[model samples]
Target: MEQHVQKQPDSPVPFFLWRHLNTVRRLVLLLVFCLLILLPYISLYQNFVAGHAYDLLTPHERRIYDVMEWLTAPIARSDPANNLNMIKGNTWSGTLFGLKLSDPLAVVGQVAAQFKLYWPFLLTALLPVGLTLLLGRFYCGWICPATLLYEINDAVRHRLVRLGILAQGRRMDLRLKYGVLAVGVGLSTALGTVVFSAIYPPLIVGREIQYWVTANGVGAGTTFFLLTLLFDLLVARRGFCRYLCPGGALYALLGRYRLVRIQRLVNRCNDCTLCDKVCPFALRPMRDAFGQECNNCTACMAVCPPRALTFRLRIQDQPDQGPGHQGPAHRRAAVRVTAKGEVA
Candidate 1:
């Protein structure tokens, strides 16, 4: 069977800077994630964690009862209210849903304690809220450690499938996210814990490295690198993102309500289907762009030959009129008018 491919467009896009910066930022974040995983054992960043934790919690969570009693200084006289101002006993089972997970390492090793020390709880709390408003789940697309892991895993799976070691499926079977969504919601509502956080890639990698570093040394760091490499180099699609992330599932719901989207002008479309092929999320960009599943990746816009498709920031929903709805006669008449204007 013969296949047709569209030629590249002549002019460049202005948003290439935005796209390039996004790509570079993601790459750097991925590297930081790697370093964070290794730092527990190498003790490069662990001291920072320890110093922060000790400075903040020394009088409360960690100081011995006698030491606390013996200290005559006014600073040593810790008020229960001061120690607990951050956490209210009125624990709503569901207020902070999808915000954070309860990982053993985060909870047990006192690193979680340190995280709160380095950054104010309110500041961290505001990130998802503010980001959700401006960029609409930008954290999920770029910074979330879990998404990065999934992207790497998916890339590996793609190569393996190409090599015939794995079979490819047309349907993404994305219903898995719904299941994870349910479990996360249920656990958070019922148990007052973000159950999904235990398996969340960030916490998983963080905790695993913490344990490994405490037990092994540089060898453990090597193991962590190899595991990350295997996931990225072997998995075809964003396996973890597609199959496991509850946070992603939550943000997808937010995307449904998000106003901004990558829209295609159907009248100008040349039927090249470049957008459909380049979409990483496996969304049919032409048919189902505004259907809440598309991640606004803009791969279609990057490849569009005539710049036919544009990222329209629309205020109202437009009807899904099918492709090239007008007849050839109407198009020819329009083209003649356009040609006459050009000649004049």
Candidate 2:
């Protein structure tokens, strides 16, 4: 809660790999997105393998069976059911290598819906909650399939803005997501359903990917997701995630005092505003204003030409550090100070 430095501290050199984390993060996002698409097909294959019904299947079914058989031949040939059971479900709630992990918001939404606790189900979310406590909304940055699409949408937004097809994305109050979370919780309580699973972009994206992959006609979620893309394109850049996601609100609350956060290195910063420009969460890393909303996506760090940003083990962001030492304002100030000294 109390974060301040009376004077700028000397720099601690960041490791070379710190900047590469965004690339690693993109790879992780793609891997997770692929897994979301792959797991459904795997489940479909598992059903056929478990039934031993290859001969009974239709031509299309047999082709799926053939491809899945070849794909899973290495590890799951013996017992696709048991062997492939190592991974199941989507990001909302999934078992991986015998460990079940779930979205924290999933648990919250369920509790609101059922009005009773299922301890076994609740336990599944602990790993993610624990990670969020330390990592501060890392799920949004590193794992959420929706985020990958949102960023692509953001890129498209930039293009459209340049072409005068759209204006710069409108900035709304960040607190709006908290209101969304409250309303969603209330609605779940009243409706007795985990309503967020339908609206939450990550869950929606995974569900849609599965449908399209499994050759099930895409669901209503596709239409909703497409609207979100348009919302980001026309209304705001990442409008839903920034202003309306309940899951994001929950993570922001949980990770309010996240132990590991990105800190600005005043010495290296040139106040060029690149970090501010690239931040997905719209955090002001250039002004040391990274708050709970920062997902530690490191797009800011990656875009830092001076390599000014780095991660630190701290509970809060440093107070504003003023203009970077390399900036024009600081240079002008320095010149004025030197002249005053000579005059004195």
lDDT of each: 0.49, 0.87
Clashing pairs in 1: 154-236, 154-237, 154-238, 156-234, 156-235, 156-236, 157-234, 157-235, 157-236, 158-236
C-alpha lDDT of residue 112 in model 1: 24
Question: Evaluated with TM-score, which candidate comes out highest?
Answer: 2
Which residue pairs in model 2 clash with each other?
A: none
TM value for model 2 = 0.92
Off by over 4 Å in 1: 1-14, 18-22, 25-35, 38-123, 170-176, 189-192, 214-239, 315-318, 324-344
> Which candidate's lDDT is highest?
2
lDDT tens digits by residue: candidate 1, 266-342: 65565667777766666665664545555555556666664556555663335664553232444555566556664
Per-candidate count of clashing residue pairs (backbone under 3 Å): 10, 0
Worst 10 residues of 1 by lDDT: 85-94
Q: In model 2, where do residues sit more than 4 Å from their true spots?
A: 1-10, 212-216, 339-344
Candidate 1 local Cα displacement, residue 67, angstroms: 36
The true-versus-predicted C-alpha distance at residue 327 of model 1, in Å, is 14
